[model samples]
Structure formats: structure tokens, C-alpha cells
Target: MTEVFSSNSELVLQRSVDINLSDSGSRHEDIRELYQISETCAFITSNNYKKVALQFPDELLVDCVAVSAALEKETNAKTYILGDTTYGSCCVDEVAAEHVGADCIVHYGRSCLSPSRRLPLMYVFGKRPINVQECAAAFRELYPDQESHVIILYDVTYSHAIDDLQRLLGDTYPNVVFSVLRADHSHGHACEPFKVRTNSDCQDDTFVHKFGRRFTLTNFMMTWNRCSFCSFNPDTSTGRAESININKALMKRYYAIERAKDASVVGILVGTLGVANYLNIIEQLKESIRKVGKKSYMFAMGKINVPKLANFLEIDVYVLVACPENSLLDSGEFYRPVVTPFEMETACNKHREWSGEYITDFQDLLPGGSSHVDFTESDHSTNDDTTDVSLITGALRSSCLRSSPEPTDGSSSSSSVVVRNQTLTMANTNAAASFLSGRSWQGLERKLGEAPVVKAVEGKRGIAIAYEEEGTERKDSACPDHKNLNYRKQSGV
Candidate 1:
């Protein structure tokens, strides 16, 4: 039996491995340079910041203590290390930093580049080695046309090689562009607001400064794929650039929007507590859902997973409000379809048309945001008589609903029943409530006075791990002094 259990079990115990640390001066210098410890110290001393918070993602937590110690020693200012983030690594945990009364935050590792509202932020993009010449050659080969308008964006890790690649690629491709690293800017929120500009050559080619860089809206926009080029083995000849099929991903997102349109209950999943304007977006989403005559439920959770979401059987779809990088959840494994705020907006507004521009950030959905579009609210009274074919289930679905009709006989109360073909039918306007009512298991049932009551009796004592029975003798008895007490009583003392 033990062998069988062991064979069928999936758990595997991993052996611990010891890593040797080098205390060499060169190694220490590299650490300081890579994390920009000197620059951070300068910023702290110049600003006279008393309390500084150092936020690092899970992967770079190994150097959290070292980085904090170096900063404290250099700046002579108290430093707090924020190892675990409440949301994601990209957005600054202003709430956590506020707990420590930190005036400034120095974020490490890859960030979603979302602007912080509370405290000023400094980004330290650790350098990752890359051969610029080789990357340039690869780019040229992939985009053979010298006139191709390409915007090259990269991960923060490979930010060091961007400038070099820009110079190399710029000489060949006139329209080629590169994204500036966020670390190049002092603070995100402190930077200037987004400005709209147009190029002289192409008046239609608009320019918007965002994500710590200026980008031109041209024919082709190249976004950096996390699994794409930049991370390559120096020894392998397979090359650096790995092409990702973006169209397929967009199609899946569009399908999710269609599914959202058919849903009767929309669950708004609050995935971030740190990002700015999250509360505003949540309220807006609730209003939008109400306007569409659909039910909306808000879920406040730490981390999102399949099982956690599957627990809510009532929710037909979920709209995740999170940072741009983490908002687009691939819901292939989830029981219900998970979509972004942008998709939800499109789904709620029947008049809105998708311009093929996928927005991952909830911030953009807010009023005065870049992706915000003005649309007239649909009249639910008129919509009650309208119906549409569901793109998902291929069933006819109601558009919206108005208030229940007044009693035909001018009575205050009315019956929610209709007689059709000599049979009575219940008219349920609330689709979600009706669906829950039809479920076999409608939660725990309190059958009051159904089962007969039994007399109370002494139950087994002790903890669950080792319960004691009435017949079992406890060696360590509580009355160990019983013999002495009996002798004293016999002596009449």
C-alpha cells in the first residue's frame, strides 16, 4: 500500500543546493553599478529624504538586503526594503511605503511603468548583457525594408543595449525608432504630462509621450514581447529574435468581449490596490454595468487564480482591473472568461466599434483618458422589445429591460405569471437570480425542527490528533496528589 501511494503521488522533494558567495571588490562594484546605488544615494541626499522605500520583485529579492544596506551606508538615511508587493512588481506599492512613512520609493526589476500618485518614484533597471551589433543585424534581416516604420521597445533588463542598437539601426532605417528606458527619467509621476504632436512629413502620424518615452503612431508599432528576442544563449546559433503571433492573441481577446456581451452578471475583479485611479475605474465599471441593466459584483482579492474564480458560479464573466502588463489574463484555463476593462467597455456599449487598438490599462478607460470615447447611453425602455443573437452560445438574448409594466386592471400589486396554452408560467426578469434558483445545490439548508433532538452526552476529550476514550487510562493524570490528600484526610489533619 505504501509503495502504491508513493508511486501514484505527484509530489517531488527537491534537494537543497548551497550557493557560494564571492566577497570580491569587483563583484561589489558590479552590484553597486548595476542597481545604480550611487545615483540612488545622490537622489536621497539631494532631496534630504529621511525615509526611503526600496521595492523589489520576487526574483530580485535575493539582493534586497544588500541593496538596502548599501543605500543606507552611502546616504546615511533610513531605508526600508519592500520585498513582497501587494499587487504586481510593475506598479509602485505606495500604500506599503506609506506604512513606513517613506517619502520616496526606489523600485527595482521589470516594471509595468504605471505612474504612481502618492510618493515620488525612481526606477533602477538592472542591466542585462546583449550584443547590439548582432541584434541590429537580426532586426535588419527580419525587417528587410529600410523604409519600414518600426518602434523598437525592449524589456527594462536589456535597456543598456537600446542606445547602441538605436545608433546602429538608425543609420540604415530612417523611420526606425527606439523606446527610452524609464530609468533615464528621474521620476514617473513627476514627469511632464502627455503632449500631442504631429510630424512634418506625415501630418497623420501623431506622437504621444508615455511610458517614459515618446512614440510616434505610424504604420507599424512594434511592442516588445516578453518571450521575444533579447534573452538568448551566447553559445547557441539559433539567434535572438523569436516571433510572436500577436493577431491570434488579439482574436482571443475579441472573442472574450463577445462572451462578455452575452453575460448577465459581470464580476469586476480588483486585481491591484497600488495603481492610481483603481477606485475610480471600479465605480465607473459598476455604473456602466448598471446602465446596461446587468448585475455587477466586485471582488477584492490578493492574487487571481482559476480555483478562486471558479468558486463564483454566479458570475458569467470577470473584468480584471489591474496594471497594463498584468491586466490581459489568458482565460483559457478559467471557468469563466476573464477580460480587460477595455473589452468590458466595448461589450457594454453596443454602439462602440473596435478600432483594432487593444488597451490593457484600466486607466485609459477613465474619462479624459486617451482611449476614452464618447457614446450616448442606450434607452433600456426601447431595448426591452429588442433582441440579438449571441455570438458565443448562438442563442437569442434580450438587449436590456425597463421597469415592470403597470397592473392592467389599475391595481397596486401585480402577478409575475402568465397563462399560455392553459399552462401557468413564471416570468423571471432577473436572469442571474433565476439561474441560481435552478441549481440543484442552493447552498446549505437549515432544516429547522426536521431532525429529532438528542440528549447531550460527554464526548471524547483531548485534541483531534489524539482523542481520549472513556476506557483509556491517562498515565499523566491531573489528580496525581490524590493519594496524599486521602492520607491527610485519614489522619484528620
Candidate 2:
């Protein structure tokens, strides 16, 4: 590929990685391998889409223009470049495509491949070369205790080199088990050989059938959901030993969901704007929250991190609705609980009993064969009968709230009000404690009304203020003590 940089080019963000820009535009190894021209051409030709939207993640922006120019020339289609996504780049930028009326999106770099609702999407997971010979040799040296059948696993970016890896390993390890990820052709993201740690050994029709039925993220461990991804059967003697790792992963997720039960406010982190059918998922989430009577806030951000979310102190938990791959944001590191949509359902939905089913893809959380949540006829028609009536209904205070406690040097008056509010908050806290104290919520407190509330005790000056409920009328006198009047003036209170 040629070094086609216009006058106004995006400045290089990182120094380590650089795309070798060619002079004559014939194409060099670095650019050609990263951007597969043949496959891209075939995809564009077959799709018959005219105006293509080329969406690139931040890291791949350097090669975006060069790749776009090539696609336009080969396919004779007008190209529009889309910048920073509102959510995680692994999600398709469906929001950005509306601006240019894009016929379809050619997404480059990391993607979760969530089913899109509107425009079709194609993923170009740029090829990153891996030394298959060295890796396999290292693997053989590392684990000698295991049987000859070793599950070859890797990140999806290095998936292109899996074949080369298998060939090198074939010499020593005769029974090398490899898994293949078949595409759901319904969405435009059907770029082949999408190996998320597995690819078809491409042996025969019998081999594929014997190994698997439907390759699905839904019902991850169903009877039909074959361990064909890997030949090691957990039921058999060999399968039992390998199953330990899978068990640990599921347990970790289960505990994470359990921890979310104590959370007061839930922050819905919109991880993908480009993903197709997020609106439906969000509705289900809001209704779920409503059913549980927990407050929900939605946030749409480009790059999500601890600092970005730390600003919202009130939010007790966060649920990321991004693509499954990008959503692996470690829960261990975050200050608060960060869970997936499926995990949120586990946490909030009372009837949703856990059966050790781990589903990262949000679509899998839906009912039946569809890609999204399917609410029943009863769910759609029926009104929410249960109204979450707050237990403490009338007011937060023990006595009637006054407009002003007879103003006396603004701070004292405001501070007195603050103290009263604090008193009410304490009462409310106590009320809430009692509200959840017993099996019947001790309906006693709700029926009997406010408890003996704590009121802030007035001090002469610079003295420790104690909380008391007695002598309420005597303290109501707004007239300042003449002795403290001069003191109050000097102290500027």
C-alpha cells in the first residue's frame, strides 16, 4: 500500500507501532498482511453496497485512509471516515453511520460482533503475525504433565496464524485438539475463520458434525452445545480434569453477581453504541430496575476507566452493555462492582435462578431463538401492578418543616437548617434500618410513625454540640445570646 497521507493527517499517538508507508503503492508485507485486500474486495463485491462507512478504532487510524482509498478504487464506492466511537470500539458505531447515510459499515480492528439492528457491518480483524513454531515449542516444554491432547488457545487477533501453529504442533502432538467458531451469517460481520482461540481443523464433513451441532454463545453448556470446540470431554476421565478451569471461571462470575445484591444505585454503562439492538436491552434493564425499585442511570462514554466513573459517587454498581469481548474489563480492579447485562439480570431479577450458565453475549440473555429479549404477550399487555410505595411517605422530618428558623446571621440560620436536615436523615436512616429489620419489615415502625429522632444540641460557643430531642421550644428562640453576639461577629459565623 502507498503512503497516502493528505495534508491534514491524524498525528501518530504511539511511537512503538508504525505502518511502513510504501512509495509506489504496489503494497509491502506490513500493510498488505494487516489489511487483507483479497478478502475485503470479495466482501465488498458480493455485498453490492455503494456508500461504505469505514470505522477504525483509535490505534488503527494511521492506516485508515490508505485502506479506505484502496476499497473505494476497487469497489467504485464512495467512502466516509468515522472517528471516535461514543462507546467501546469493539461495538459497531451505528450512531455515527446515520450522519453520512452509510449503506454498510466496514469495521476495522477489535470487534465483539454484536448483532446489528439497522445497517450491516463487516469486521476486518487486522492480521498480527505470531511465531507459531516458537509458541508450540514453548507449549511442549511448559506443560509435560498433561496428555498429548492440548487445547491450543489464543486471543482472536493472532487467530489468522492458527493453521501455521497446528502444522508445527502436528509433528510432536499427534492429537492436537482445535476449536472452530462458525459465523452467524444473519449479520454482516460474517468475515470467515473468526477463531476466538479455535478454528476448524478443516478435516471433513464427518469431523465437523461429530464434533458439533450449532456453534452458539447462548446456553454455553447445553447438551447440544458440544465440547466440540475442544475434543476433551468433561464427562469422561480426561474431561473431568480439564473441567476444573471452566468451573473456577463460572464461580468467579457467580460471586460477582452475588456481591451486586447489596448495591443501592446501578449505573448502566452503555458500552456499545454501534451494536445493533441496544434499545431493547436497555428497556428490559429499566423495567428490571423498576421491578426491584433501584435507581438506574445510563452513561455513554468513549473510553471507560476508573477515573471516568469515579466522579459519580452515588452509583453503587455499574453494568457494562458493551460487546462480549471488550466487556472483559476486570471486576477485580474497579472500585465498585462492574458486571455484564446477563450478570445484572442475575443480580436484580428475583425469579432468574442461576444454573451455572455463563453467557457474555447480551443477546443470549433473551428468551427463545431470537438475538434479543422477547417479552411475552402478557409482559407487553399487563400493567405493572406493584407500585413501589416508599415506606416513609409523608416527610423526612419529625416536626413540620419551616421556611426559615428566624434568620440570624445567614450561616447560623443555614447551619441550623443543615443540622435539622441531618437529624431527619438520621431518622430516615434509622427508619430504613427498621424497614428492612424484620420479616414483615416490622410494619410496627411504619404504623407507629417516626421514632425518637436525634436533634442537634445548641452550644454556647466553640463547645461540643450534642444531639437531644428535649427543650425544643426553648431552642426555637432565634434571638442571639448577647454575650455570643460579639463572639459571633468576631468569629465571622
Score each candidate by Cα lDDT.
0.66, 0.57
Ten residues in sequence with the least summed lDDT for candidate 2? 205-214
Candidate 2: which stretches are off by over 4 Å? Answer: 1-30, 170-175, 183-259, 306-313, 330-336, 351-358, 369-493
Q: Could you tell me which residue pairs clash in candidate 2?
A: 1-27, 92-274, 93-274, 94-274, 116-276, 117-276, 179-199, 233-239
* Candidate 1: tens digits of C-alpha lDDT, residues 257-357: 89988888999998887778999988877767766668888898778877678777789999999877778767887888998888998987666677667
Clashes of each: 1, 8
Question: Model 1 lDDT vs. the true structure?
Answer: 0.66
What TM-score quantifies how close candidate 1 is to the native fold? 0.71
Could you tell me every candidate's TM-score relative to the true structure? 0.71, 0.55
Considering summed lDDT, which 10 consecutive residues are worst modelled in model 1?
A: 210-219
Query: Which digits, one per residue and each the tens of the lDDT, describe model 2 over residues 322-394?
Result: 7766664566656677888877887666466777645666765655433334322343223333322222232
Per-candidate RMSD, Å: 10.9, 18.3
